[model samples]
Target: MRFTIGKLAKATDVLVTTIRYYESIGLLDEPDRSESGQRLYTEDAVERLAFIRHARDLGFPVETIRELIALQVDPGQDCERVDEIARHQLGEVQRRIAQLKSLETELKRMLSSCEAGKIASCSVLAALGHHEGCLHDEHGGQEVLAKPPSI
Candidate 1:
Protein backbone atom coordinates (compact mmCIF):
# COMPACT_ATOMS: atom_id res chain seq x y z
CA MET A 1 0.00 0.00 0.00
CA ARG A 2 1.16 3.54 -0.72
CA PHE A 3 1.27 6.17 2.01
CA THR A 4 1.39 9.92 2.09
CA ILE A 5 3.94 11.81 4.17
CA GLY A 6 1.48 12.53 6.99
CA LYS A 7 0.48 8.91 7.31
CA LEU A 8 4.11 7.79 7.23
CA ALA A 9 5.03 10.26 9.97
CA LYS A 10 2.17 9.11 12.23
CA ALA A 11 2.96 5.46 11.67
CA THR A 12 6.68 5.92 12.34
CA ASP A 13 6.43 8.41 15.24
CA VAL A 14 8.60 10.85 13.36
CA LEU A 15 7.71 14.40 12.47
CA VAL A 16 6.56 15.17 8.93
CA THR A 17 9.06 17.98 8.76
CA THR A 18 11.89 15.67 9.82
CA ILE A 19 10.96 13.18 7.10
CA ARG A 20 11.08 15.91 4.50
CA TYR A 21 14.41 17.12 5.87
CA TYR A 22 15.84 13.64 5.52
CA GLU A 23 14.77 13.60 1.91
CA SER A 24 16.41 16.97 1.43
CA ILE A 25 19.69 15.63 2.78
CA GLY A 26 19.68 12.52 0.54
CA LEU A 27 19.46 10.25 3.59
CA LEU A 28 16.00 9.28 2.32
CA ASP A 29 15.44 9.22 -1.39
CA GLU A 30 12.57 11.37 -2.60
CA PRO A 31 9.39 9.43 -3.19
CA ASP A 32 7.65 9.16 -6.56
CA ARG A 33 4.98 11.74 -7.37
CA SER A 34 1.51 10.96 -8.57
CA GLU A 35 -0.06 12.63 -11.61
CA SER A 36 -1.47 15.17 -9.15
CA GLY A 37 2.11 15.82 -7.95
CA GLN A 38 1.44 14.39 -4.51
CA ARG A 39 4.29 12.30 -3.19
CA LEU A 40 3.55 8.57 -3.13
CA TYR A 41 5.53 6.20 -0.94
CA THR A 42 5.71 2.46 -1.48
CA GLU A 43 6.18 -0.12 1.26
CA ASP A 44 9.92 -0.17 0.69
CA ALA A 45 10.06 3.62 0.99
CA VAL A 46 8.15 3.50 4.26
CA GLU A 47 10.47 0.84 5.61
CA ARG A 48 13.50 2.87 4.58
CA LEU A 49 12.05 5.92 6.31
CA ALA A 50 11.56 3.84 9.45
CA PHE A 51 15.16 2.69 9.29
CA ILE A 52 16.43 6.26 8.88
CA ARG A 53 14.34 7.49 11.80
CA HIS A 54 15.48 4.62 14.00
CA ALA A 55 19.13 5.34 13.26
CA ARG A 56 18.61 9.04 13.99
CA ASP A 57 16.89 8.19 17.27
CA LEU A 58 20.04 6.27 18.19
CA GLY A 59 22.19 9.35 17.37
CA PHE A 60 23.64 8.15 14.06
CA PRO A 61 24.16 11.07 11.69
CA VAL A 62 22.70 11.19 8.17
CA GLU A 63 26.08 10.69 6.53
CA THR A 64 26.68 7.41 8.34
CA ILE A 65 23.13 6.27 7.60
CA ARG A 66 23.71 7.00 3.92
CA GLU A 67 26.72 4.72 3.95
CA LEU A 68 24.78 2.07 5.82
CA ILE A 69 21.98 2.28 3.28
CA ALA A 70 24.47 1.69 0.48
CA LEU A 71 25.95 -1.22 2.36
CA GLN A 72 22.44 -2.56 2.84
CA VAL A 73 21.77 -2.43 -0.92
CA ASP A 74 24.71 -4.59 -1.94
CA PRO A 75 23.69 -8.12 -0.83
CA GLY A 76 27.04 -9.61 -1.87
CA GLN A 77 28.91 -7.27 0.51
CA ASP A 78 29.72 -8.34 4.07
CA CYS A 79 27.66 -6.73 6.87
CA GLU A 80 30.73 -6.24 9.03
CA ARG A 81 30.66 -2.50 8.25
CA VAL A 82 27.16 -2.26 9.66
CA ASP A 83 28.35 -3.97 12.82
CA GLU A 84 31.20 -1.47 13.11
CA ILE A 85 28.75 1.39 12.83
CA ALA A 86 26.55 -0.09 15.54
CA ARG A 87 29.58 -0.59 17.77
CA HIS A 88 30.58 3.06 17.39
CA GLN A 89 27.07 4.19 18.20
CA LEU A 90 26.98 1.90 21.22
CA GLY A 91 30.24 3.33 22.50
CA GLU A 92 28.87 6.85 22.11
CA VAL A 93 25.67 5.94 23.97
CA GLN A 94 27.68 4.37 26.80
CA ARG A 95 29.87 7.46 27.06
CA ARG A 96 26.81 9.68 27.38
CA ILE A 97 25.35 7.41 30.08
CA ALA A 98 28.55 7.60 32.09
CA GLN A 99 28.65 11.39 31.77
CA LEU A 100 25.04 11.67 32.92
CA LYS A 101 25.77 9.51 35.96
CA SER A 102 28.66 11.75 36.94
CA LEU A 103 26.54 14.86 36.51
CA GLU A 104 23.78 13.27 38.58
CA THR A 105 26.18 12.76 41.43
CA GLU A 106 27.29 16.38 41.35
CA LEU A 107 23.71 17.63 41.11
CA LYS A 108 22.60 15.50 44.08
CA ARG A 109 25.47 16.92 46.10
CA MET A 110 24.55 20.47 45.10
CA LEU A 111 20.84 20.06 45.84
CA SER A 112 21.22 18.26 49.17
CA SER A 113 23.67 20.79 50.50
CA CYS A 114 21.42 23.78 49.77
CA GLU A 115 19.56 23.30 53.12
CA ALA A 116 16.79 25.68 51.92
CA GLY A 117 18.92 28.60 52.98
CA LYS A 118 18.61 32.13 51.58
CA ILE A 119 18.89 32.14 47.80
CA ALA A 120 21.94 34.43 47.77
CA SER A 121 23.89 32.29 50.27
CA CYS A 122 22.52 28.92 49.05
CA SER A 123 24.89 25.99 48.58
CA VAL A 124 23.39 25.53 45.13
CA LEU A 125 24.55 29.00 44.21
CA ALA A 126 27.95 28.36 45.75
CA ALA A 127 28.33 25.22 43.70
CA LEU A 128 27.37 27.02 40.51
CA GLY A 129 29.45 30.08 41.22
CA HIS A 130 32.70 28.21 41.50
CA HIS A 131 34.85 29.66 38.70
CA GLU A 132 36.55 27.23 36.38
CA GLY A 133 34.51 24.26 37.67
CA CYS A 134 31.28 22.37 37.02
CA LEU A 135 29.69 18.91 37.32
CA HIS A 136 30.70 18.49 33.69
CA ASP A 137 34.28 19.32 33.01
CA GLU A 138 35.23 22.34 30.87
CA HIS A 139 35.32 20.05 27.86
CA GLY A 140 34.04 16.58 28.82
CA GLY A 141 30.55 15.16 29.52
CA GLN A 142 27.00 16.31 28.75
CA GLU A 143 27.45 19.67 30.51
CA VAL A 144 24.00 19.78 32.05
CA LEU A 145 22.85 23.19 33.20
CA ALA A 146 21.63 23.60 36.80
CA LYS A 147 18.53 25.25 35.41
CA PRO A 148 16.94 25.63 32.04
CA PRO A 149 17.54 28.88 30.22
CA SER A 150 14.88 31.58 30.35
CA ILE A 151 12.50 31.37 27.42
Candidate 2:
Protein backbone atom coordinates (compact mmCIF):
# COMPACT_ATOMS: atom_id res chain seq x y z
CA MET A 1 0.00 0.00 0.00
CA ARG A 2 1.49 3.32 -1.05
CA PHE A 3 1.17 6.40 1.23
CA THR A 4 1.67 10.09 0.66
CA ILE A 5 4.20 12.11 2.64
CA GLY A 6 1.54 13.25 5.13
CA LYS A 7 0.42 9.69 5.74
CA LEU A 8 4.01 8.57 6.20
CA ALA A 9 4.64 11.36 8.73
CA LYS A 10 1.54 10.46 10.69
CA ALA A 11 2.43 6.77 10.62
CA THR A 12 5.96 7.36 11.88
CA ASP A 13 5.29 10.39 14.15
CA VAL A 14 7.93 12.35 12.25
CA LEU A 15 7.42 15.81 10.82
CA VAL A 16 7.00 16.17 7.06
CA THR A 17 9.91 18.58 6.92
CA THR A 18 12.06 16.05 8.81
CA ILE A 19 11.11 13.36 6.32
CA ARG A 20 12.10 15.66 3.46
CA TYR A 21 15.35 16.53 5.22
CA TYR A 22 16.10 12.85 5.74
CA GLU A 23 15.56 12.25 2.06
CA SER A 24 17.72 15.22 1.15
CA ILE A 25 20.53 13.91 3.38
CA GLY A 26 20.13 10.35 2.02
CA LEU A 27 18.91 9.03 5.31
CA LEU A 28 15.60 8.05 3.75
CA ASP A 29 15.51 6.71 0.21
CA GLU A 30 13.94 8.84 -2.49
CA PRO A 31 10.41 7.54 -2.68
CA ASP A 32 8.40 6.86 -5.81
CA ARG A 33 6.32 9.78 -7.08
CA SER A 34 2.70 9.57 -8.16
CA GLU A 35 1.37 10.61 -11.58
CA SER A 36 0.60 14.15 -10.34
CA GLY A 37 4.05 14.43 -8.63
CA GLN A 38 3.00 13.54 -5.09
CA ARG A 39 5.60 11.53 -3.15
CA LEU A 40 4.59 7.89 -2.71
CA TYR A 41 5.92 5.78 0.13
CA THR A 42 5.70 2.08 0.76
CA GLU A 43 5.72 -0.02 3.92
CA ASP A 44 9.51 -0.13 3.72
CA ALA A 45 9.70 3.65 3.95
CA VAL A 46 7.37 3.68 6.94
CA GLU A 47 9.50 1.06 8.71
CA ARG A 48 12.72 2.91 7.90
CA LEU A 49 11.32 6.20 9.19
CA ALA A 50 10.22 4.48 12.42
CA PHE A 51 13.72 3.13 12.89
CA ILE A 52 15.19 6.59 12.38
CA ARG A 53 12.71 8.14 14.81
CA HIS A 54 13.49 5.61 17.53
CA ALA A 55 17.23 6.09 17.08
CA ARG A 56 16.80 9.87 17.29
CA ASP A 57 14.66 9.57 20.42
CA LEU A 58 17.51 7.61 21.99
CA GLY A 59 19.82 10.59 21.22
CA PHE A 60 21.85 8.83 18.53
CA PRO A 61 23.35 11.42 16.16
CA VAL A 62 22.26 11.46 12.53
CA GLU A 63 25.66 10.31 11.30
CA THR A 64 25.59 7.42 13.71
CA ILE A 65 22.08 6.58 12.57
CA ARG A 66 23.28 6.61 8.97
CA GLU A 67 26.05 4.21 9.86
CA LEU A 68 23.51 2.00 11.59
CA ILE A 69 21.30 2.00 8.51
CA ALA A 70 24.24 0.98 6.37
CA LEU A 71 24.93 -1.84 8.76
CA GLN A 72 21.34 -2.99 8.46
CA VAL A 73 21.71 -3.33 4.72
CA ASP A 74 24.00 -6.28 5.35
CA PRO A 75 22.52 -8.48 8.05
CA GLY A 76 25.38 -10.93 7.83
CA GLN A 77 27.88 -8.39 9.16
CA ASP A 78 29.03 -8.76 12.77
CA CYS A 79 27.40 -6.45 15.34
CA GLU A 80 30.68 -5.25 16.88
CA ARG A 81 30.40 -1.91 15.13
CA VAL A 82 26.87 -1.46 16.41
CA ASP A 83 28.09 -2.24 19.92
CA GLU A 84 30.86 0.33 19.54
CA ILE A 85 28.40 3.02 18.46
CA ALA A 86 26.13 2.23 21.40
CA ARG A 87 29.07 2.35 23.80
CA HIS A 88 30.16 5.72 22.46
CA GLN A 89 26.66 7.12 22.85
CA LEU A 90 26.50 5.73 26.37
CA GLY A 91 29.78 7.42 27.28
CA GLU A 92 28.49 10.74 25.96
CA VAL A 93 25.31 10.38 28.02
CA GLN A 94 27.34 9.59 31.14
CA ARG A 95 29.52 12.66 30.56
CA ARG A 96 26.44 14.86 30.23
CA ILE A 97 25.00 13.39 33.42
CA ALA A 98 28.16 14.24 35.30
CA GLN A 99 28.10 17.78 33.98
CA LEU A 100 24.43 18.17 34.92
CA LYS A 101 25.16 16.92 38.44
CA SER A 102 27.85 19.52 38.87
CA LEU A 103 25.49 22.23 37.61
CA GLU A 104 22.81 21.03 40.05
CA THR A 105 25.21 21.06 42.97
CA GLU A 106 26.39 24.57 42.12
CA LEU A 107 22.83 25.89 41.70
CA LYS A 108 21.77 24.42 45.06
CA ARG A 109 24.76 25.96 46.76
CA MET A 110 23.97 29.33 45.24
CA LEU A 111 20.33 29.15 46.34
CA SER A 112 21.31 28.20 49.89
CA SER A 113 23.64 31.20 49.99
CA CYS A 114 20.73 33.55 49.40
CA GLU A 115 19.82 34.98 52.83
CA ALA A 116 16.34 36.20 51.71
CA GLY A 117 17.64 39.71 52.24
CA LYS A 118 17.59 42.66 49.85
CA ILE A 119 18.96 42.15 46.31
CA ALA A 120 21.87 44.44 47.17
CA SER A 121 23.05 41.88 49.74
CA CYS A 122 22.06 38.77 47.72
CA SER A 123 24.82 36.18 47.64
CA VAL A 124 23.17 34.73 44.53
CA LEU A 125 23.79 37.95 42.67
CA ALA A 126 27.33 38.13 43.96
CA ALA A 127 27.98 34.54 42.93
CA LEU A 128 26.60 35.23 39.48
CA GLY A 129 28.81 38.30 39.20
CA HIS A 130 31.86 36.29 40.27
CA HIS A 131 32.23 32.67 39.12
CA GLU A 132 35.01 32.20 41.70
CA GLY A 133 32.28 31.69 44.32
CA CYS A 134 31.06 28.53 42.55
CA LEU A 135 31.58 25.27 44.44
CA HIS A 136 31.76 23.44 41.12
CA ASP A 137 34.00 25.36 38.75
CA GLU A 138 33.09 23.06 35.85
CA HIS A 139 29.44 24.26 35.87
CA GLY A 140 30.24 27.55 34.12
CA GLY A 141 30.13 26.23 30.56
CA GLN A 142 26.76 24.47 30.64
CA GLU A 143 23.99 26.25 28.74
CA VAL A 144 21.13 24.94 30.91
CA LEU A 145 20.04 27.24 33.74
CA ALA A 146 18.42 25.93 36.89
CA LYS A 147 14.95 27.19 37.77
CA PRO A 148 14.56 29.72 40.60
CA PRO A 149 13.73 28.28 43.98
CA SER A 150 10.28 28.91 45.41
CA ILE A 151 9.79 31.64 47.99
Backbone N/Cα/C clashes per model: 0, 0
**Candidate 1's residue-wise lDDT over 1-151, tens digit each?**
9888888887877778887887888877889988999887788877888888777767786789899998987899888989999999899778767777887787787898878968878888888888344655642443432232211
The runs of at least 3 residues in candidate 1 whose Cα sits more than 4 Å from the true structure, single-residue gaps closed, are 131-151
TM-score of each: 0.84, 0.88
Pull out the clashing pairs in model 2: none
Per TM-score, the best of the predicted structures is 2
Residue 31, candidate 1: how far off, in angstroms?
A: 1.3
In TM-score terms, candidate 2 sits at 0.88
* Top lDDT prediction, candidate number: 2
lDDT of each: 0.76, 0.85
**What TM-score, to 2 decimals, does candidate 1 have?**
0.84
Tens-digit per-residue lDDT, 1-151, candidate 2: 9999999988988889899999999999999998899999999999999999888877787899999999998999899999999999999778777888888788798898789999899998899899887876566334434331110
